[model samples]
Structures are given as C-alpha cells and as structure tokens.
Target: MEDSPRSQELLSLEAIYPDAELDITSYSGTITISIHSADPVGISFAAVPNTQPLYDSINYLPPLKFFFQLPETYPDTPPTVALLSLWLPEATLTALHASLLLIWDDFRDMVVFLMVDHLQEQAFVLFGLDPPIALTEVQFEFFVSYNREQLQEEFDTQSFTCEICQQYKKGKSCLRIELCRHIFCKACLLEYFSTCITAGDIEKVHCPDYECTKRVAEERKRMADPKTFITSGTSTRDMILRVVFTPPLSLDFLSFLPPEIVTRFQTLFTRDQYEFFKSNFPNRAVNCPVEACGHGIIRDDVNDDLVVCPKCRYAFCIHCTNSWHGKSMCRLAVRLDIPEDVLEQYLSYPELSKDRRDLEDYYGKFKLRRAADAWHMDVLFKEMMANELMTACPSCGVVSAKMDGCNKMTCHLCKTPFCYLCGEFLDRARPYDHFNDPVSECYRRLFEGMLGTEEELMRPIAPGFAL
Candidate 1:
C-alpha cells in the first residue's frame, strides 16, 4: 500500500529528527520514545497523512516537535505519532497513555484537532478580542474579517452576560457559564455560587437568567467528567489526534486496507505497560516488594508512590522501586546495605530519570531512615570523611596521631621534629621540650586547657558527665 499523502509531509519533518539518536527504545514489543530536551521534544509518525497535497497542508505551525515511526509494511498498518515535550500534567499524561489502547482502526487526528481548536479559542478569549465565531484553527487574519464584526454584534445582544453583575461576557479564565443561547464567564458563575444571592445560595452554578438553567446544567454535567473528552468509541479520540497529529486523517476511511486491520492495529502499539519484577539475586521472589502483593502495577499506576500491596500495609519504594524498608525495625547500619544499587541503576536509566524525579517531588514525605545501625555507620563515615583530616603532610601523615589526640607532637621523620601543638618546624637548638622542662610554657598551657587545672582535674566527675 502506498504511504498516505499526509504521511509524506510528516515524513519530511521526521527526516530532520530521526529515531536512532533520540534514545528511543522498544520494550515489551512496543516502541517508546523519551523526550528529555529543554527545547520542544518530539515524536515521529511512521506514516504521514496522505490526504490533501503536502503543499496545501503546510500551513499549520505546531509548537511541539512531531515525528512518525513507519514500520516496513504500509497501509496494512497505521503509524504511531509521538508527541514530544507537550506540557501535559501527569494524570492527564497517564490518561492519554491509557486512551491509546482504543484506537482500533482510525488515527486519532480528529480528537487532536478538536483539543487544539479549543485551546485556540481559549487563546482568543485571553487576547481581548471578540470571540471567534467557529472553534477551528484558522489563521489570525481570518478572525479579522467581516463575520467577526457580525458575530460580535450578535453576541453583545445575547443574554450571555452575568445577570447579577450585569457584565456582558462569554467566558473568563476560571469559569465558563452558559445561559439560553449564550455562554457566561466561569469566574462570575463560581462567585455567584459560593456567595449569597437574592435567590438562596446557588447550590450548583446556574445561569443568572432562569431561562438557561437546564441547558447549563446538562453541559456542566458533561464537563464534570473528564472521561467525556476521550473514551473507547467516542469522537474525542479523533479530535485529540487532530491536535497531536498535524493534518488529521482517518485511516479507516482509506480506499485500501487489511481485513483484520482493527485487531492488528490495536495490539501493535499499546499505551499501557504491565509490570513484573525479574530476579537478579538468587531465590529472591522477584515481585513487587509490597508484602502479600501479587498484583503488579499497570502503566498508569507507575506515576504514583502509593503502590499499596493489595493485601497488606506494604508500600513499595516508589523512588528505589524496591520493597518498603522504612517500616522494618532493622538499624540504619543493617538496612544501609539493602542493595540500593539496583534502584539506583533503574533510576539512572535515561528514560526513568524525569519520571523518577517527578515521583520524588510528589512523594517527598516518605523517605525512610529507620535503621539505628545504619545511623551509627553514617555518623562514623561522616566523621572519617571530615574535610580537615582528609589529607595530611607526607612526612608526619602516618606517624602523627593528630587524628585522635592533641596536635602537639614530634614527627619521627628525618629526626627533624616539629611542634605538633604550635605547628612550628624545629631543630636541635630549639628542640621540642617535654612536660618535665620548666621552659615548656606552651605544653603547660595545652595540658591545662585540655585537662583543666590540677585542682579541678584531680576531682572526678559523674560517669555521664559531658565535657
């Protein structure tokens, strides 16, 4: 089968951003692409849209980088479009990944287009212009035409205005209120709902005008459920694909295609990834560490740290992706050896870093440090690694016991001793004086300072007394 005309145009874009160099991976029989760059990340579609002439469809300028991954076989299968670096929230991203399972036979171009159209409408409202007449991606100049003026006049006369505030408007940043044959600002509706009104409290947001209540309620119900935007057989997928895929195309409507296209296409690229652990160490039951947890994580669940063991209080480490060690009674020293390396390696993998970081930020409260032994070891390590003692003079390095005792001492090196107390190099003429020498005023001061005065030092203190 020949490449779709739309596919050709997108292929040209992919030619610039190929698969090999971009850290693309194929795991569990599905292609996965990583988007780590600070710039707009990208995904390539294997087959480009093949409908209209490439030149004619060249007008849309998408901010995200787009790409296609074409399998060797054509038309018999649909290509996957990878959306790069788009600012989607984690929950939304998880939803999108799950939604990909229902594509069946058509490319989701329509759904993408609808979302983009909605976003563009939002942008227009934000820019202080008269609302665009249609929810489509038309050039900015198109909104400047005579129809805009007519739409503006018609909209101004409509009952879309908030009745309480008497402000004529369609929608605001936070609210979207609609009345009979018109939409009101969401901000106004919310304000009216929470505050006192002449007609009792607005239990649910209602059009200030009583005539629009039924229509507004119906629309509000649909908006409350996010699932309405994308579902198994709905046009939501079609609309979403249009925004994510440039020049949307319906593969099911193609003139030629395979008989089992839907089944085969659905299975080839999954939006979901089921997880199970494989053991690297001997006899270890390589499963999710959550106690009594036989159930594994679905791709969507991987986004959160609350991986509860279906049967118990066992929660796996979302960071190290290990069993929960925080709840155990082992001392810190004992638990410190809990092969954190595997978790480190898994996290260091390029694809998992961003995801790991996000999970870290979300579950920041759960870092476990329960082991007392581990705490002791940590203190010892820190003391040994203190900055001041990390290095020493070559001559006195091994001989001097400055690490544990008073600094005043002589180095055995070269028989040319130095005052460890004063840190002064000395010769036989001014040979170091021991405690017995009357001229050893420095030694007397040092001993007095460390051991206290003879009278006070002679007195014993309590066993637990601290210096």
Candidate 2:
C-alpha cells in the first residue's frame, strides 16, 4: 500500500531535517531550525542601561524548535504546532506560533518546509521586532553561547584550505583567529606559535597572515592616535580607558596553542609590555626588586619615592628598591665590589703598560676600563681609608663617607642616604626598619662595626629599642 499524504510529508520533513526527531506512526515530530542573518545581528541587555550594545557581528542566533502533530486529515486541516526557544520570550514564541499557523492557512498543502524557511529567514526581523534585540542578561548570555556553538558546529562540518599548509582540511583540524578571522590548520598554527614563543619573539606570535598582521598594526596605530577617537566623537578619557583595559591582540588567539606554550607566551608578553613601559617612561617606571615577581611599576608621585608593586603587593622605595621606610632617609645602594686599590692600580699604569695589559687579560678589558673611569674622580679627592669607609649612592653613584654617626650615610652630591656598613639602599621614611626586621641579614647589626664614644652606636639595636 502506498503511503498516505501525511506519511509522505513526514518522510519529506525527515529528509529535510535529518537530525530532527520524528514519530512516523503517530505523525508527530520536532524540527530545530537555525536562524541565520545575512548581516550580523546586534545583542543588547535590557538590564544594562546606558552602555553600548554588544556588537559582536553575530551571524547565528539560537535555534527555534518546532513541535508539530499532523491531524488525521492534515492537508484539509491546519497542523497543531508550537514554537519553543530558550532565548526568545514566551510572547515572541506565541507570536511565532501564530505566524506558523497563518502560513498553514495560506499554503494548506506541505507547509512545514515553507514554515521552516520563513523562520530561518525572518525570525530576527519578524513580528515588529528588528535588529539590536534587547534581552535580559541571562537570555543574552544563552543566545551568545548558543550562537557560538552553532557556528562551531557549522564550521566543523565544512572544509577549508589552510593558508599556511595550502591543503584542504576539516574545520576541526583548523583554528580561526578570533581577531582577524584568519583560518589556519591546527598543526601549522601550533608549530608556528610554539617556535615564536620558544624563541622569545613575542611580537611575532600574532596572526601569521601578513595582511592580517598589517591590518592589526594599522588598527593599533589608529587607536594610539587621540585624533582618531576625537573624530569619532569618543572622549579622551574613554580612549585612554580602552587602550589601558584592552588586552594585546596576541592574547586573543591563545586558545589555539598548547597550555605550556600559552603560559610561556603570557610571560614573554608581560615582559615585553614591561620593557615597552620602561622605555617610554624611564624616570616614572621602577623595576620591582622581588626576584620572582619583577614586574615594572609606574610611579605616581615623583617626590614620594614609595612604590607598591600591583602584581606582588611589595611596598618598596623607588630610590632604594627596598622595603618602604616610614620617615627615614634613603641609604646609598651602590655596590663597589671591586677593591678601590685594584681599580687605582689598574688606572695608574700607562694606557699600553704590560702590567695593565696583563690585568686586562685576566679581567675583561672593558670591565676594568669602566670601573677605573667610574671611580677615577672620587678616588682623586678622598683618602684610601675614607674611600674604604665611603659608599656610593645607588641613584647618582656619588661617594659618601660616614664620619661619626649611624650606619645610615647620606650622599653629599645627590643626598641619597645609605647604609655605610653594607651599602644597601635605605628608605628615607624608616631607614632603621631595615635593621629591626628579624629576617633581614643586617638586622641588629646596624652598630656592629662601630666603636669609640658614640653613645648612639653603644645603644642596643633591637626590636622596639630606639637608637
């Protein structure tokens, strides 16, 4: 026996939506139709007022599932149908359901295909609703996630030729950079990005496509210019905030890389940013002294030398690069490790003396030359005993000797205070705190080398004991 018209329609619907769930005996089925827009649709949240709508240029929206049952005399009678959607409101679904029924009234024969087509094409714009769809926050999130999943699903089924390998591959074996939308095979991208990161070429770790890289550079140039934002009516404050908050483009494609590579890329990227910052603002930027966390910190106040590293929460003086001192003077931190006698002896010999040449051969010629030049003027003025007692300021490199006071000696030239015993930089705010901290190597040794009738030096340098 030949199938009935309803059975024929069910078979046709099954053919049209291979993934749809259908009950052939009962003549009932559910077909999910994906809504695609020619132009990217805008999504906005009604909960977030006054903010710019998120314009991700989303081409796919959450799908609408059509649940329908064919009546016994389906061609003559309208089909019973309902629209269900996770993102769309109940009122919109109800309107869509009515629209589906109206289509059945107009084309009573084989209306499922026509209904599906109408929904696919007009769902975003139908029923007096247009683009920039305003939804609740939860709905908006669901829509975005659903759209991304659908897009990935579609992409995974398609075939594309990777520009790098010049070979056709399925989307599952490829990666599409989110910023530039340039596609490359996963193997090619992984190898290329891994090499760049391993070589510390962090700047070259972005999109490998030359055109995309150039376009990104141009975009960055445009963003850097204040006039670009001004011409577009964006406030300078907004432009600054955007530049400061926006992550680098290299970070956008990290999903394509392995976890270890991603970590290395992040570390290199941070170091690159720190170098760039230091180059641009030499005086204002200070390097954190913490060996493990050497992030660059930008100083807000020039007069106040205290700097707190944002990444490590380490509070140190900018001049001394040590723990923040409450009110004590900053101590000289210059390391005069090479003996002044050795440096003077090296300088005493003629430029071509065999003795100097021998010393230069033992030590690097450049090293001895630089050391001699650095201490030449200071050695000429101060005596040998005074030179041994003196410590140079870490900031200005000027030598200052301690005569009869505490270990904290301030440079006469640059006025930078330093510990005379160890030449460690002292914070101007609370210089004695360095000696008071139990973990410090110089703790309680502030007056260790001092002798004679200095009452302050004889005083105990302990916790809570004022010197």
**Steric overlap count per candidate:** 47, 17
- Cα-based TM-score, every candidate: 0.20, 0.60
263-287 per-residue lDDT for model 2 (tens digits): 8877777777556545543544577
**What TM-score quantifies how close candidate 2 is to the native fold?**
0.60
Model 1 clashes, total count? 47
- Model 2, C-alpha of 256: deviation from truth (Å): 3.7
Lowest lDDT block of 10, candidate 2: 224-233
Mind giving the per-residue lDDT tens digits that candidate 1 earns over 1-467? 23553455334433543442321231001122321222221122212354332111111222323233434333344445443423333454444334442342455332322222333343333312221212222332332333334334545555455556657664322222211333445555444533422233322323456656565456435433323333335443243333222111123321122434323322321211111111111111124554455543321222233455545556665445465566443232233223344335334556546544442322221231222234545555456435222223345553343433343455556554555544455455655455435776455533432345564477564232355
By TM-score, the best candidate is 2
Off by over 4 Å in 1: 1-268, 271-326, 329-361, 368-384, 389-467
